[model samples]
Target: MTTNNPMRTFDDSRRWATDGTAMLTTAIEQLDASGIAAGSQLPGWTRKHVVGHVAANADALGNLISWAETGIEKRMYASTEQRNADIERAATLPADELLTWYARGATALEGAFDRLTPQQWQHEVITAQGVTRQASDVPWMRAREVFVHAVDLGTGLGFADLPDDFLTALADEIRVKRGLSEDDLRAVSGSLPDVTAWLAGRPHGIADAPELGPWL
Candidate 1:
């Protein structure tokens, strides 16, 4: 999927960020119409919690972008506990406020990315997992946050709700993450619609294989 065009990565990243914000906006609107409360999902967490977490991740990435640009290490948070507390605080906001904050956070992130030079995209940053990765991976990471947590909210939407190109790219990414080869993906092939379901840990056509957990 390489392109001869320069700035392809930047263009793809910008598009991903824009599309992700639109999806989140839609999800929040649906949540409002459905009258779903914050505490609708996992124990001790609500729809607000999920939204807040997504916002927090955007904020973190925004900070990382700033650090990359300035050559100064602006720590995203004091600690993991602080990050979790920030999410909790954001979650306590009213549904309207939380949704608005999520939108603002996404916008802020995109703004940070827009300021980056092409060379800065590949600048190394240490991840929470202690692995170093390119700054360009930030949008993809945030996309996973938005998309997967959208599913966690149990909105009944899955990868199928995304563009087919996005789903195919995501499936390829997941296959690599799960240590599956191209042959493995081909062996269990059915339809493009099933790829999302299979990636989300649902049993589809392949019964003998171990249950696929959430890889994104």
Candidate 2:
């Protein structure tokens, strides 16, 4: 059931998930009540909203895992309105309880990953965007969420603090998603983290790069 490419294996997915969660946990741990109430990098949301959103995202991904493993059609959320409402409601939790929710959701997601069989990893699941992809893609999906949202928390962490390999993977994935070719934009280049940030529509003050549209 193993592949010649290690990156495609379940072990590699687990590694990415583990590393991403650790980074997110650290960021969450650093937030104080006042810090949680402060506006985050996200346009109108507070740090509490970002944390709650991340926790909900973990639960959503866990639903996809169940869909793959059980051959049942589990929707990521009931609907977008429900999802937003859930985040807003969760964001009201006290800072300590919010962190506890995040930790619990993350652990449940990891357990879901562990339950996946090799065949289940290849099963198709639909994202909230209605795009269908194999379950194997979930790890990188979660990685992108965690890494990007950690920066969104605005707790002194930035894209620069992410691991180089994660940044590289994120950049490559974003390029594919956005239908970007090297020639599509101005010839902008940087370290992997900076490139990832730029591609995700964060301005890095790198002149000559084409102005990118918002990623989300």
Candidate 3:
């Protein structure tokens, strides 16, 4: 449902899901030997933490995909505290091991996604936050994780560098997710990148803007 590229079917989201993984992988690999240890845009999170969290998230979403496939109730995480503990534990691994973690988790999730039927994609599953959504949304959720965290790595890629359609859908989603009204959107400039970057709580340099809390 996002990106500059033309996506004409459900199949296309699968493609972007793969593409986003590759994008993040390349960004991580390109980092200097010490870069993965550097701070990310996220507070108190190194690039290692960001990548590790994305890895865990892939596996967590795979649980939802399995739920959709089998009609069983599978929570995204065993518990919120456990989830935090997992990320913290993962963040301490060596950089090469972190890449292994990401590869294994992402590969498994991608394989799980590949097997679902069209009807299965429509199945409802709950998020860690208690939000219920379609199983098909899982791929986009992964895409956002990799793409946004690629930028959060603080190496390079910006909102403008992501696919245009992706940014458009992301901006729209954040607006609704944030419960922003017309007036709220009007508070930012109409530029899609600027608006999305602002909505995402990135450093958009919105002059004299009201301070925004953290965003997803």
Candidate 4:
């Protein structure tokens, strides 16, 4: 599998963010009118929960971008408790407030990315797990958070809702992330509907499910 080209990755990130924002905006518009208050596909998470998670991720990625620029290693949340607390705090805000915050977070993220110099793109940053990655990985992370969580909201959207190029890129990423050989995926090829389905682990007929869930 080919590693994502930096320029392509950057461009894709922008597209993903733009597309995700559009989806979220539409969802929020409907949600506002319907006053639908319910949990989503993620266990115990309401629509609010999903939006909060996406917004929090945008803020976290913004911080990571700042860290990359400053050459500082930022620690991920100290614990799941802290992480959940933050999400809950954001989720509990008034619906309109939460939506505004969510939009602002994305706008801020774009602003931050716009300011990054070419050299900064190659700068390495260490994740909380201590794994180092290129700064370009930041936007990819943001894209995943926005796009996946948008679907997780149980808003009748799926990977199929994504652009073809985005789906293909995600499929390639999923293959590598899951350590599945191209041959392995090809061997079970008939089972999978598309790259997105394979990425979601809902490959048409593969019954032995992978340990990882659809979150990836």
Per-residue C-alpha lDDT of model 3 across residues 54-111, encoded as one tens digit per residue: 9899989999999999999999999989989888987788888888888999899989
State, as a TM-score between 0 and 1, how close model 2 is to the true structure.
0.90
Candidate 4 lDDT, 1-216, residue by residue in tens = 112553245767766877876776677567862342577777777888788777877777777788767777665555668778978886678888888888888888888888887777778776645677777777777776767676777778766676677666676678777778777666554322354565665322445544446544
What's the residue-level lDDT of 11 in candidate 3? 58
Q: lDDT scores for all predictions?
A: 0.70, 0.82, 0.82, 0.69
lDDT of candidate 1 over 111-198, digit per residue (tens):
8887888777767776655656777777777776776666667666655666666667667777777888878877775666476558
TM-score of 1: 0.81
What global local distance difference test value does model 2 have? 0.82
Clashing pairs in 2: none
Q: How accurate locally is residue 171 in candidate 3, as Cα lDDT from 0 to 100?
A: 76
Off by over 4 Å in 2: 1-10
> RMSD in angstroms, all models?
3.7, 2.5, 3.2, 3.5
Clash-forming residue pairs, model 1: 38-46, 38-47, 39-46
Better of 1 and 2 by TM-score: 2
Model 3: lDDT equals 0.82
- lDDT of residue 40 for candidate 2: 86
lDDT of residue 126 for candidate 1: 65
- What are the runs in model 3 whose C-alpha is more than 4 Å off? 1-12
Query: Could you give candidate 2's per-residue lDDT for residues 49-121 as a string of tens digits?
Result: 9999999999999999999999999989999999999899877898889888899999999899888888998
